[model samples]
Target: MNSKLIKELPDLVRNNVISQEVATTIEAYYQSQQANSPNRLFTVFGVLGSLLVGLGIILILAHNWDNFSRTVKTGFAFLPLIIGQLVVAFSILKHKSKTWKEASGTFLFFTIGSSIALVSQIYNIPGDLSAYVLTWVLLSAPLIYLLKSNVLAILHLIFITFYAYEIGYGHYYSNETPWLYLVLLGIAIPHYIQLLKHRTNDNITSLFNWLYPLSVTIVLGTFVKDLSELGFLMYVLLFSVFYNLGKMPFFDTQKLRKNGYLIFGSLGIVVLMLIMSFDSFWYIEELVFFAQESYISILLFFVNGVILGLAYYKKWLQSFNVFQYVFILLSLLYLGGLNLPVLGTVIINILILALGITTIKIGADKVHFGILNYGLFIITALVVCRFFDTNMSFVIRGLLFVGVGLSFFLTNYIMLKKQSSKAKTL
Candidate 1:
C-alpha cells in the first residue's frame, strides 16, 4: 500500500474530491491487500534463525563431546531430531503460516543430517562421505513436499547434485553410475511444477529455473564412460533440449534474466560451435558411433531428439531462434567431420556467422541493446578464434578487431538513438 496515498485520502475527502465513505472503503481495501501479501522478509529471517540455532546447538554439543559418556552422547544425538520432529508436527497440525512451516522444515532437515552424523560418530559407524550425503538427501526429500518448503527443495537439488558428482566422478567411485540421482531429481519435479503453476513470478521459481539446468549440465559429464569425443555432441543435444524447453509458453513469457534454460542453451551451443570451428576438433583418428559403451550417449541423443521433435510439433519454430536449429546442423557436421574435417570447420564458421547476423537482426527489430551487444560479442569471439587458428598477419587481425569495435559502437549508438526517440514519443 502507498503510505502517501493513504495519508491523502483524508485530505481528498475534506476537499470533497472523494466522499468520506469512499476514502474509508479505499483505506480498508488497501489494508486488506497489505495484510494478505506474504511477508518474505519474515520467512527469510525465520529460516535463517532456525539454521543458526541448529548450528549453535551442534557447536555447543561438539565442545563437550570428550567429557560425555556414551549414554549422554546418544541422547544428545536424538535430541535435535526429536525437537525438530515436534516443531514440524506442530507446524502441520496447527496449519501455521508459511514462515513457520519453512523454518521448522529447514531446522528439521539439518537435524536429520546432524542426527545421522552424530549417531554414526558416536557408535563408530563405517561409511563414506558419499553414502552419508545420499542417506541425508533421501531422508530429507520428504520434507520438501510435506512442509511445502521451497528452501528444502533447493537444498535437495544441491545435495543431489553433490551426490551425483561424488558417485559419478569421485576418486574412489569413478566407475559407478549415479543413476539414483536421476530418480531423486524426478521426485522433486512435482513441487517445481506446483511452483510454476501457483507461484509463477516467485523468487523460488526463478532459483529453480537457474539451478535445474545447471544441475543437469554439471551431472551430464558423469554419464560419459567411453567415446569421450561424443560428449560434445551429447552436450549440444542437451542444450538444444534446454533451448526448446525455454521456448515453451511457460518460460517464454518470463523475463530473459529469469530463463536460465534459454541463456544456458544459447551460450552452450555458441561455445561448442566456436570450439568445433577449430580444425583440431574435427580431426579424428577413430570415430565410433555404435560402441556398446556409448549407449548412454546414444540414449540421451535419442531422447533429446524426441524432445526437440515434440517442441517442433508444438510450434517452437514460430519463435525462430537460430540456436534451436544448430543441434541438427551440428549433428550432420559431426558425421561429415569424420571424412572431411576442413568442410566441417568451414561449415561451422559459416553457421556461427549466420547466427551472429540473425541475432543482430533480431536485436535491431526488438531494439534490445543487450541482444545487439551479444551478437557483436559472438562475431568478436569468432574473429578472435580465427586470429589464433589461422596464419593471418597481425595487421589483418588488428584490422578485424578494429572493424568489430566500430560495429559494436555503431550498433549501440543506433540502438540508443532508437530508444531515445521511442522514449520521447512515449
Candidate 2:
C-alpha cells in the first residue's frame, strides 16, 4: 500500500476482472438494479390495482347490502381470502410462467390476501392482526423463492417493515416486532443469497438496504422501553454502521454508500446522544444501575472490531472512520480493566499514545493517509477520556500528551524510512 499503489486501489477494484467476493457484491448490486426498473413499474401497478379493487369492493358492499343477507355478505367477504390463498398456492405450483408474470401473479395474490384479511376484520372475522400479518407474509414468502422475483421479496420486506413499525411504534408496542424481523429476514435473505449466486441483481441490494434498517429500527426501538437504554444503544449502533462503511475497501465507496450507511448511521448518532446522556453508567452506582446483557450492543461491538481488522488487513487507513473509533470507547470499557477508575484512565492515555504511533506509521506506509483521521481520533479519545474522567491531575495529563506527541514524531521518522525501503521492492 505505497502512496502510488494506494491511489490505484479503487480503479483496480472496479475494472480488474478478478470477480471474487468483490464481484459477487458488485454483480449482485447491478443485477438487482436492472431488476429494479421493472420492479418499480410492477410495484406501481400492483398498488394501484389493490387500491382500485379495494375501492370497488367497498362501493359494492355499500350498495349491495340492500340486495344481500348477512350470510351472503359474509360469503362475499371471504371470497378474496379463499381465492387469494388458492392463487398463491397455484403460483407456487405454476413453474412455467415468465419470471415477470409469475412475480406479478404472486404479488396480486398477496394483495388479495391482505384485502380478504382486511375485509374479514371489518366483517368481525375472528383473527389477531399479527396472525393475519404473519399469514400474509408467510404465504408470500415461498413466491419469493418460487418465482425468483425480487419484487415479491421487497413486498414481503415492506409487509414485515410495516408490521414491525406497528408493533414497535404504534399505540400497541407488542412483541410482534421480533417475529416480524425474522419474517423479513426469511425473505430478504434469499434475495441476498441470490445476489451472491448471480452477482448481478441491483434490486436485491436495494431491498436489502431498504429492509435492514426498517427491521433494525423496529428491533432497536424495542430495546428501549425507556430513554436510557435506547441512548446507550445509539452510540453502539453508530459504531456498527460507521464500522460497516469503513470496512469497505477503498474501491467500494459507491457500493457501500448505496447500502444506505448514512441514513442508518444518522439514526445511530441520534441513539448516541441517548446513550451519552446517561453519564451515570460511567461511574460507580452499582446498586442504583441495572445493567442489562445488551446482546445487540455487544454484537455490534464485535462486528465493529471485525470491520477495523478488515480495514487493517486491506491497508485501508485513509478510509478509516467507522467503527474504528468505537474501539477507543470499547477499550475504555474493557471488562478487562480498561474501564476501571485509575486503571482505565491510565490505559486510555497509553492506548491513544500507541494509536497515534500506529496511525503515523501506517500513514507513512500509504503516504496519502490524508490528514490521518485514525491518529486524530486517538487524540480526540484522549481528550474525551480526560474530559469525562476528571480523577487525574491536569499536569500529569499534559505531560502524557506531550510525551505521546514526541513519540508520534519519532515513529513517523522511522516509519517513513521503512516504507521507502518497502516501496523500492515494488
Candidate 3:
C-alpha cells in the first residue's frame, strides 16, 4: 500500500464510489503501514557517512605518511583499525540496529584494508595488488555474515573478482591458479543464498546477477589454450548454462541488465553462431582434437558434459531453447565427418534463422517490446551479414533489406495497436 495508490482514490470519490472520509482513512492506513518498513534514506546516509569517514582518514594518513617515523606510521596504521573495531563492537553490543551495523561494518571493512596497505607499506612488504586484494577480501568476508550486510557482500564480490583478474587470469604474476578464484568465490555464496531466501527483490540481488556471469567470463579463458579449436564447443555449452540459469524463476523476472546471464548468453549464442556460419572458421588450421590432452581441456570437456547431462536430465527441450538443441546438432555435424566446411555453415545459418523466429514467438507470448525488437534485430543482422557473406544478386539483396524494414515497421505497429487495445480495456 502506498500514498501513490491513494491518488487514484480521489477519482473514485468524485464518481460517488466513496466518500472523502473513507479515502482519508484509507490513505492514513497505507501511510501507517509504510512507516513500519525500514527507512532506506537513513540506511543510505549511514552507510555513506561511514564510507566518507573511512576514506577521509585514509587520505589524511596518506597525505602526511612520508614525514612520519616508523614508530608513528605503525601506530597510525593500527589506529583506524582499532577505531573501526570499536565502532563495530559498539554496534553489536549497544546499537544493534541495521543502520548501525551497516555503517560500522562498512567502516571497518575499509579500515582493515587501509590498515593492511599502510602496514605493508611501512614494513616494505613484498606483494602485489593481487595479494593485497586477496588478503583484504579474506579479512572482510566475515563482515557480510557478522553484520548481515548486503553492501559488504557486494564489496566482497567486487574485490574477489578483481583478485581473480589480477592473479587467476594472469593480469598479475601469482603462483596461484585460477582454481583458487573459484574457491574464494564460494565464500560469498552463503550470504547470497540468504539474500535470495529473504530479500529476493533487494537491490543487492542485482549484484549477484552481474558478479556470477562476470566471474565466468573472466575464468572461461583460463582453460582455452588446452581445448584449442574445440573450445568453441565448450563456450557454446557455457553460454547455454548461463541462458538456462537465466530462465530460472528469479532471474527471468529481472530487468535485462540485471539478468546478466540471459543477456550475455543470448548475445554470445548469436555471435558464436554467426562466426560458425563462416566456412573459414570450420576449416581453420588450429581446429585440432585430443591429439595432445591437457588438464584444462579435460576440465572443459567435463564441464560441457555436465551441462548437456543436466539439460537432458531435466528435459529442457520443452523450453524451446534453440541453442540447446542446436549445440548438439552442431557437434554431430562436426563429428559426422562432413568436413567440407559448408555443411557446418549451412547448419549454423539454419539454426540462426530458427532461433530468430523462435525468439520472436517468445516475445509475442511475453508481450515485451524489447524482446520483440531484439528478435527482429537478430534476424536483421543475419540478413545484413549474409548480404556480404553471400554473392546474391543486387536486386535480391535490395528486396531482402526492404522486406526486413517492412517487417520491423509492421511488428512495431502491431505491438502499438495491441497495447492501445489493452489500455482501452483497462
Q: Give all TM-scores, in the order shown.
A: 0.90, 0.56, 0.85
Ranking by lDDT: 1, 3, 2
TM-score between model 1 and native: 0.90
Please list the C-alpha lDDT of all candidates, in the order they appear.
0.88, 0.55, 0.78
- lDDT by residue (164-207, candidate 1, tens digit) is 99887886547777889899999999999999999898778988
Mind giving the per-residue lDDT tens digits that candidate 3 earns over 1-426? 665678899998999999999999999888887776667789889999999998888888889889999999999999999999999999888957788888899999998999998888889999988788988988888888888887788788778777777765665334455566777789888888877788776666776777778777766655455444666666766676677677655677777768887887788889888887887767744455553323444464455567656757876545666755555665666556245687778877888998898888778777788888888998998898898888899999999999999999999889888888888999
Better of 1 and 3 by TM-score: 1
lDDT of 3 at 142: 84
Looking at candidate 3, the ten consecutive residues that score lowest on lDDT are 291-300
Superposition error at 140 for model 3 (Å): 0.9
Best by lDDT: 1
